[model samples]
Target: MTEPEGSEPAQDLSDQDIFAVLDSDHRALLELADRAATTGGADELAVHCEQLVMLAVRHFVAEEQYLFPLMRQHLPDGDRSVHRLSDAHRHLESELRRLEDVERSPQAVGPILADVRARLVDHVESLSQAFASLRGEIDPAEAQRLGDDVLGVEQLAPTRPRLDHSDSPALNKLVSLVEGYVDRIRDAYTHRGVERDER
Candidate 1:
């Protein structure tokens, strides 16, 4: 599949590593959060907020599909770690959905956005700690293979949060296939409108 427009070129998973992939996503999310927090206009805030949610959803799904399972196999106390991360994922997804609703309403969303930002920061810190704990637990080659698997999963991951379904990998993939197509169509439509407005 072709890389989405505006996405970085697909990296060789063996050479690139999962940490780099996840770090890139985390940076994009932090930047989006900053923009959302600072933007004065509701329309601009909404756009940044939407992008943040999409990226977060994709990142979490990729970890669930590939990273956590590998951790379960390699890390000590892996089950507890995966459970903690999964809980955080669910909470974040719920918050994103709430933010979406608030965005659509006439109500002010500054406080909600702030709360989301705080949660995201905490989540990233916890994830970093988990990764650090995994150092020397698995071979570098095995880690690279797992990272490659995650990259493949990410290519087909949903760009929208899916809070309604159970967290099964198989189910997530099926739902993502449908949601990813819809997201692409919506993005294309929005881009065309922007181009028309720019003319």
Candidate 2:
């Protein structure tokens, strides 16, 4: 796991494995996003938007349900980012609503759509990087096991992404996004699992 140059967390989470998985999903997201961005008409746009939004909604469900609060509890102002991420999710939700309203392949919401995309992308990148910093602080074995415990979110991936992938920065980030989301989700689920098993 790479460390943030400085201002590193006292601990870091295991991200390499998550990044690998998400990188693949990110590719699929990009493919869908690209289609949405370049659609010849609103009908096509709606179809593409549906694909993107559904995937994002499922992803948002897992992240908000499991990850951010854990980080906030552990790191300085780490919890602050949790709210930021949640706010970003709201932005996604609003955009999804807008997409749903496009009855005639509407063309007026480009600027609004663009802003939503920018906010969401920034949220994903920053959170992953923050997690990377935290990853640096923990024991190697702890980190690896932590990663496994949290990986249940992948098993919960809304739908499987295409099996094969090619290179792209956009896709890479998406992959990281998936990995990060699951890592956190798994963490939450793991805690819950332990509680259940104990009971």
| Cα lDDT computed for each candidate against the true fold | 0.70, 0.51
The most accurate candidate by TM-score is 1
How good is model 2 by TM-score? 0.57
**Could you tell me which 10 consecutive residues in candidate 1 have the lowest summed lDDT?**
190-199
* Cα lDDT of model 1 by residue, 1-199, tens digit: 2222244674444465677667666766776777677766566566667667777887888888777876787777888888888888888888888877774422566777777788889878877866776656767777677667667766667766675644576776777778877876876667521223242
**TM-score for candidate 1, residues paired by index:** 0.79
C-alpha positional error of residue 181 in candidate 2 after TM-score superposition, expressed in Å? 20
Write down the lDDT that model 1 would get. 0.70
Report the C-alpha displacement of residue 62, candidate 1, in angstroms: 0.5
State TM-scores per candidate: 0.79, 0.57
* Worst window of 10 by summed lDDT in candidate 2: 1-10
lDDT of 2 by residue, 1-199 (tens): 1111122342333344433333333444545555567667654565556556555654554444434534665667776777676666666677666655655354554654566567566755766776676667555665455454344544444322222221332453466467556644754654421223232
